[model samples]
Target: MADLESGEGKTPVIDIPEAVGVFDTFEDLQQAFYDLRMIGIHHSDISLLANEKVLKEKLGKAYWRASDLEDDPRAPRAHFVSEEATGELEGAIAGGFFFVGSYIAMAAMLTPASTLAASIAAIAIGGSPSAVIGILLARRVGKHHKDYYTNQIEHGGILLWVRLRDKEREEMAVKIMEGHSGRDVHVHSWSK
Candidate 1:
């Protein structure tokens, strides 16, 4: 147990080997559990699997209790997606394309399409700026809210958790989990 503290009043960065999925509601969490299972991703209830001593010592008693779901089976099981299966990364990249595509379509429609080359040129020109801005904006949002999301999970809003197979899988997992997640999805390396 190294010093988990990273900053004052911040959730100590525990060395965990899991990705936690945070959702706003219990239904969303449950749905994710079933959805992942459908795709053959083995998942387990974190509350049932977490080491009580490590949880209590690192995250505090409140989080420990929050992680526990044995007392109430009806309550959402804080799911931990295993290091298997896959998630969509194309969605994030496609979002950038879609955002830019809309403007390109509108511009092409409003202006005269005298030639296919002209239309193509308009799309290329318009799309470059829009795509850059869209991707940057998305990245900014993630950077700005990273802390807020981490705090939310610390305060017991974490609805699900997963241990990705690797970094690439983690990236994809974030996108997929974020799609279903109500609040946020975070990847952490938790020592067993």
Candidate 2:
């Protein structure tokens, strides 16, 4: 664990990719947490922070303190694919849906069924594949985000941040923080 304090009353710099939001009061911090939860992110994935002294004194042994000497083998690891990989995955999913849906719809057209029935059947069958793909994607993305956030927490003290699972969620998190007058709102990338 590196020293979390650069100077008195200042927050330490983080090296990993992360989204950070700073609040003036604990109330504001709680509100940000509430808003994030309302937007579908859970409380477990968020971290709250105060100044260095406050955090060190209040959290005491409860806080995660890292040494600058060597990597902590006990530190949590992020196992999910990177955000860039997820983007590529989403593209592949879209292409697959397009190709598979078109083929299924065309094949259904050849059957001796009414136009409406064939269209409905095609849509219903096509949705199955989409649902399956969507589920797998969501699970992997969610796990990755959660694990990365956990790793961040274990590496340093709580810093009032959120782990973004997608672009829309990232945007919404920034908006919510800025809307609440959060300062130093930054997005950083973490590498393992």
TM-score winner: 2
Q: Which 10 consecutive residues of model 2 have the lowest summed lDDT?
A: 66-75
Residue 120 lDDT (model 1): 69
Q: Could you give candidate 1's per-residue lDDT for residues 81-138 as a string of tens digits?
A: 3212212233365476656676875678566544777776777777777677666665
Worst 10 residues of 1 by lDDT: 81-90
Measured with C-alpha atoms, the lDDT of residue 3 in candidate 2 is 31
lDDT of 1: 0.50
TM-score of 1: 0.36
Stretches > 4 Å off in candidate 2:
1-17, 50-158
lDDT per prediction? 0.50, 0.56
